[model samples]
Target: MSWTDGPFMGFDTETTGVNTATDRIVTAACVEWRNGQTRERTWLADPGIPIPKQAQDVHGISTEYAKENGRPLDEVVIEVAKVLETCAHAQVPVVIYNACFDLPLLNNHLVRLGQPTLGERVDFLPVIDPLVLDRALDRYRKGKRTLGALADFYQVRGEDNLHDALVDVRQTIAVLRAICTAYPQLGEMDLRQLQEYQRGQHRQWAEHFNQFLLSKGRSADVNEEWLV
Candidate 1:
């Protein structure tokens, strides 16, 4: 069966802000799809800091709501980490949209909470990042490459609640499936080969983006790392 056939995990997080170093995960979701069925786990964490109005506007999770109904940040992080670690050990492909952002942010949270980072716990591999793949495959296609944009581009039906963790994960998986349908060769690749291909594609995209920034007299700050 193709990698897209079954047994993949879709992960997504709604956070306080864009800075992975300081932002906290307010909500996260993992949806494991196998044999045409899906099991989902979701978390709402009291991030222990004010959820800025700007961020709240995006995911609609306010600090007050989180504090009232959420688990402790440490508890949420531990549970999420366990799910990720289990996926790694099982070699299940984890489908993430912008993996570089989410993976590093989760690692930062683990370090902040005095827990072992994901890298120390397991070899997180076989990641399927539709963002990197879409850019690589459709280099010149313009407009936007946000999850919502790609969903629309790929004709993947998405819910109105685009920014919610669960909704985003579901849409991401749909978009990935649509991408595989368009690029049949991607369905033929082994998990490891697909992982390496995305890694290389991300690096090349980063380098090119950095050069564009430099040409515009801006700092070339994009990290070339795929999962950092």
Candidate 2:
């Protein structure tokens, strides 16, 4: 069956900040979407560090709350990696809103915990990123493309309570499904073809964005890969 037929794993993370390399994960979610139903698992990690006020405000996960209710970072990291790897090897396309951020963040945490990264467990697994796909498909659509915005624009049926990992993942899956329903061309390609296509598409956008930055007299260095 095609990946869109359902059983896609939608993954998302809420971290301390935008620096995936240094920021710690405060919460993570993996939601399996199949035929309009969902099976989800979530992780909340204490991170063993301060959660910036800005990050806490966005996700509503305060440092004190995390410390009180969350699990050890090492334990959560290992479990999340295990679930993601299982999904990948099971051929469930990992659906993400902005994969470039979340996947790398997960990997960085895994490394810090001395655990295998997701790639170490699964090889070239299929990834479906709605952010990359939307940019490639609707390059001229002028507006924010955040999870909440996309959820609204796509008319996805769900509460778009972004910043919370589980809510974001569920909404991300909804937007993806809506995209498939609206654009048959996207659904025509199999999972591997879709992944390969996004690689090129993401490079094109990165180059364009780089030029835009340079035009503003800023550094134009940006990773051009879609998948981390």
Total backbone collisions for each predicted model: 0, 0
C-alpha TM-score for every candidate: 0.97, 0.96
- Please identify model 1 stretches exceeding 4 Å from their true place: none
* Candidate 2 lDDT, 91-173, residue by residue in tens: 88899888999889889888887877888887867889988888888999999988888888988847455678999988888
CA shift of 53, model 1, Å: 0.9
Local distance difference test values of all predictions, in order: 0.91, 0.87
lDDT comparing candidate 2 with the true structure:
0.87
Deviation in angstroms for 145 in model 1? 0.2
Query: On residues 1-228, what C-alpha lDDT tens digit does candidate 1 reach at each position?
Result: 888786889999999999999999999999998886888889999999999999999999899999999999989999998998988899998999999989889999999988999889986557899999999999989899999999999999665669999999999988988998899999888898898899899999999999999999999999998874
Evaluate model 1: give its TM-score: 0.97
Model 2 TM-score (2 dp): 0.96
- Give the top-scoring candidate (TM-score): 1
Candidate 2: regions farther than 4 A off: none
